[model samples]
Target: MNAVFPTLVPDHRCGFWTDGADELETALRRRADVLREAAGEGTRLLDLAALPDGDGAFDAVIGDQCLEHAVTPEQRLRGQHLGVLSRIFARAHALTVPGTRMALTTLTAGRLPRSAATNRALVDVVREIPLWRRCLRPEDVAKACGRWWEVREVDTHQHDYARTALAWLGRLRDREAPLRAEFGDQCYAACLRAVQTFAGAIEDNQLSLVRLTLWRTDQ
Candidate 1:
């Protein structure tokens, strides 16, 4: 791990993977002595459902809460990325050999039925969020993976997500001046707003946090 990503601790090595320009993927790759393609993007990355090519070579794969942010805006509003979600699963399946392990933590949405609509909490709070625009119900994700993997467990982290969001808000508050200085006042304000809204959505059950585990199968 040290040779691959000198800056990262083992705990974060697997869960936190991102290659966006703002992220440190490039800098980290330069620091790596053994790991290759640590900064891969587009066709190179083992991404959020990015990296369309999967070679059935990996022994394990893990991802943090990034899938929601990677989908189209239309899918975000609808509770799943209709056009791209399955493609992501298929690509991932192609990459993983049988019996490989996979884990994913993602933001989830309420499983409300369309016909009997009485819960107004979501309507009152769920506005057009820019960053965390998309969400998936656990079943949707499970179905996507069932063809290639066996579902093992699904766990909810709603309350934890709420607390985590609040903690972020607190940290931003504590570092308001420095954050404003580096990222600008407008950016800081936007961060605050996004966190607050996310916290609220988690509390209202309109948004949730989930962890899912699967085992790649012979199928």
Candidate 2:
């Protein structure tokens, strides 16, 4: 389907792409035909809770880093999880010619640390509200997705994340000047430190990236 921030790294595989940063008119000018527009954040656009009409109603959907930020992490394991996810899946299923597939990739915290400080740090970043995150386990994610769709594959990449973070840190440092020029020192510096922290955490394996795939099954 469409990606919220698809233009981040261009690839020919996507059907529709949009970036939030671009002006609406400018985005439209780039591609005159923007079949459906859903405002608001993330994949949970209540407007399209039901399937759309006509040919472009996509059967196959793909998302990345979208669901983890759900208002409540534990909600996935709760009963509402099925209803919420099912509505989206059913709509996507309707668009496909009976056998279209949907794939979603996301990151989940690998394991919860026993330390209260670490838990609070996670919660703080997750809610972005400077509060401690309620800890979640990997099983929580798997169980949530399992109820509604068949999980075709699951994988995790753990080791090189630290190295990756180091690279990111260096890049942010190098680009700080240009970033500050475009977005001011305050904004640039804030972002630089944030990225640096993320990279540092990943490098230490204190954070992890998890990938999961779900396929809609015909009833």
Candidate 3:
């Protein structure tokens, strides 16, 4: 797991952890993360379709860099995510109320068609991110959630994402020796390459780090 952005807030019980791996529960707990996983449990989002809508259980669900990796590295897994976006949105709708919303941040495609360089960058990213992803445009996501929510705002942080990627790449490279020792050479290389790919994608306008805020509508 890329501990780079683990969504933990110090001196506040504002954030909670929800991951599929039971092994991470202990680690998250140690970091003062309100662990949502028990000793034996599955991911809440995976089987979210089965559970009845909470109808206001959560204040909001933040899909931070989560949607892009919703599809696994294998194409067969894409069906479970891209094709079933409604299920995911349904779960989100069920979790919040009329006024609450889902705030999502992920990689989204721009209006421009992808160039060859951009396509190549994507290949490197897929290899490093280990996900067979479908780039969902911001509008596409809004349409997918149309039944349950409204797109209140869609902000593109293109340059910022590019800069952040470069910064992360630098920080990661600074610790390359230890990272290589811990994660093996291939994994370390992949992580480094992924950051480079993202920087390229953001620079070329092939991708943007988007903050899409969806407001709940009475459905």
Candidate 4:
């Protein structure tokens, strides 16, 4: 798992895998005492960008909403996001043996049931939100996989994403007072706008939540 909090230790004694940025590492260090007590030696938090030398150690790799933020907005705008994704796939391939599987979920730009202009507009709106760096199409993802991976399945969950966004929006509205106080009015307003825009895009079929299942090919 990349950038996900491990809630349960593996019962099979296999190590729990997770990685994140430096800020996340610092935050985790603050809770080191509690985490050390709860996780003991089962958890191994690593650096995603520079994974240590452990060839063919992991059975599977899972990343949820991690790929969307893999690169910066500048990289995406410069048409370097696909190259970065390909490199990431290659690195993952080097760490696993043939037949190893990888599952990733990310926000993708939708191209059906809506006009191209509308879809582009929606993408632009969401791209303006903080931490939302990349929003590639399904075809772009497949292209990035290249020879390192064989794509098994690509599933879209626009409705599910819209529902989740709506629920989040409702919660935000309910706690607007405390949230505004904590994050300030401007930050709170930005979050509310971001969620609303995301929900609208998903509802209009302009944006989708995509899950991809891929297998490492012999390389």
Candidate 5:
């Protein structure tokens, strides 16, 4: 088994290590333990798509809630989301050796039945957010991996996600004044609405968090 070294973590600001990005650095500083652990490990935070290292340099990769933004709105409109996702998988394949394990967590459409209008409304609400791309179905993710990876396990965390969103919503509500002052009333309101929408969607089984564990296939 390959040891986990030089692990690549994409979009680290979402409660992960820093990649020298200002926002990420700030986030890392907030988590002193993670900052210290990363420092001790000598981890290098490199861009997923543009790593300067040679191929097969990493032993593992973790993509936490970042795959949704792999494709642009235009690509999604053109029905190329899967292709874009496949390209990202290919890039990861090139950066890891055979038997490397990758763990990815993403919010995806749920199996629950919802009216077409409701689904359309949800899409409209999130479509304008540059980072909030369309959520993929679980099978779409498997297809995106293609022959590059073997899906080891897939787990759903709908209730957990809903609870977390609710907690965030409560915190935002409690800190309304301070948050609004810092981020502006409009931005704060939008953020609150987005969190509420996600919470409701998760609780209604219209959205779910899927965690996938995959092993890199032999090239």
Candidate 6:
């Protein structure tokens, strides 16, 4: 199954996946190869949103912790640049020859209704008072994806993800010397701090995963 990666970034290496691997071991091997190629610089990852005639022809798509930053939130819920999102979804739909699936991992704030209401309140208050903008909530993501795709699953990566992020932050801190040498001190420090913030937020249940899948029906 071919997949499209919209708004893909160059410097932040995301990782890799393989298609049609029912066996775990086989998929692991294929994933290892993809990782090796990603690390070895054999494949040229291009920006999908920028590709000309970049529609249709894939069976599935996988995105992790992306799309939120792809377009500004103002552009999403406020009915701005929705055409772009629809176009991407159309291509993804065409890729699946009907009854196929698209699995995506996106950043969301979970499905608790009260939490959503509170977050909205926070956003409204911030909008009026002018403080830091809160991150996107799962409801926002659901509304966005529901525009073009039928969602099948929504999972909250609450506490475990926080632990994972903390672990990653710790590892990055440990590799400070090498990271500083490669990326310079300022960038490395900023990234390290960002990692900690993300972990803290996730563990605190302020950030979550809005797991989703979409299947195209013959129309």
Q: What TM-score does each of the candidates earn?
A: 0.63, 0.54, 0.62, 0.68, 0.70, 0.56
Q: How many backbone clashes does candidate 6 have?
A: 1
| Angstrom error at residue 214, model 6 | 2.1
lDDT of each: 0.55, 0.44, 0.55, 0.61, 0.64, 0.47
For 30-96, candidate 3 gives per-residue lDDT tens digits of 3222112210122233222233533545554456556665544353234444455666776777776
Q: Report the alpha-carbon TM-score of model 3 versus the true structure.
A: 0.62
Q: lDDT tens digits, residues 1-219, model 5?
A: 011101111222223323344344454344434323322232433234344455556766667667776767678778899998888888888887655677677778766546786676566556534444567788988999999988888877675566556656776788889877776777676666666776777788888878777777895
After superposition, candidate 5 runs with Cα above 4 Å error: 1-53, 111-124, 127-130, 181-185
Residue runs of model 4 more than 4 Å from their true location after superposition = 1-50, 53-56, 111-130
The predicted structure with the larger lDDT, 3 or 5, is: 5
TM-score of 5: 0.70
Candidate 6, superposed: residue stretches over 4 Å from native: 1-57, 73-83, 110-135, 146-148, 177-188
What C-alpha lDDT does candidate 4 achieve relative to the native structure?
A: 0.61
- What's the number of clashes in each of the models? 4, 3, 0, 0, 0, 1
- For candidate 5, give the lDDT: 0.64
Q: Kindly list the per-residue Cα lDDT of model 2 for residues 79-137, writing each as its tens digit.
A: 45444555555555555543444444344445446678655555444443211132234
Tell me the spans in candidate 2 whose CA falls farther than 4 Å from its real position. Answer: 1-59, 69-83, 114-141, 145-148, 159-164, 181-184, 204-206
Looking at model 2, which ten-residue stretch has the lowest summed lDDT?
A: 5-14
Return the candidate ranking by TM-score, descending: 5, 4, 1, 3, 6, 2
- Tell me how far candidate 5 lies from the true structure as C-alpha RMSD in angstroms: 9.6
lDDT of 4 by residue, 1-219 (tens): 111101111110111113432232343343333323322232232223455565645546565556776877788899999998898888877876555666666778664544676556555554545444467778877999999888887767665566556656776788889877876787677667666776777788767877677777895
